[model samples]
Target: MTAGTVQALVVCSTASGAVTSAGGPVSCGTDAKGNPLYLSTVQAYVVDPASAGYFDAIATPFDYTQAFGFWSVAFTSVVGLYFACLGIGTVVNFLRRA
Candidate 1:
């Protein structure tokens, strides 16, 4: 494995039996073997207004290998669409007399 960055997310359960997420996506550094060193013992806390202490806890367990996937046509399609829209907008703006 090689050293790199990985993505993580946090899911929390409040004291009032409410479930929420604190992190949609956060970047973390990996070790030389491309292992998420910090995810080994990762956790997060949240605030619950309905609770006494108004706090919650989240378990942030993730696998570095599970973070990566094979590059697919979806990426290419999105990039293509972006550039296509930009080019169309530029041409439309340039041709406008106003």
Candidate 2:
């Protein structure tokens, strides 16, 4: 979540039927017949430099224009609401004086 850091969702699988990571082989537990059980899982990790290029193609660019438009709309809404409340308050004050 920091600058220059790349996050990746990795699905661990083994062509040879043995899952592994940098530490060592990953295992869930033994089966009823005592065979080693491997579990494929979805894991999130910070991608290394070597694999960063693969993720670049899927990365989305920020849209500044759209963001600016949304900000303008929000500002306008707040200003309009303030003026509306001021006008209502002035009307109530005038009626009370009458």
Which candidate has the highest TM-score of all? 2
Q: Write the per-residue lDDT of candidate 2 for residues 1-98, one digit (tens) a residue.
A: 33245344434344223356665667666767777666454445566677677678668698899999999999999999999999999999999999
Please give the range of 10 consecutive residues that has the lowest summed lDDT in model 2: 9-18
Angstrom error of the Cα, residue 96, model 2: value is 1.4
> With candidate 2 superimposed using the best TM-score fit, by how many Å does residue 13's alpha carbon deviate from the native?
22
CA lDDT of each candidate?
A: 0.47, 0.68
lDDT measured at residue 7 in model 2 versus the true structure, 0 to 100 = 45
| Alpha-carbon lDDT of model 1 | 0.47
Error of 1 at 1 (Å): 45
- TM-score of model 2 relative to the true fold? 0.42
Residue 28 CA displacement from its true place in model 1, Å: 49
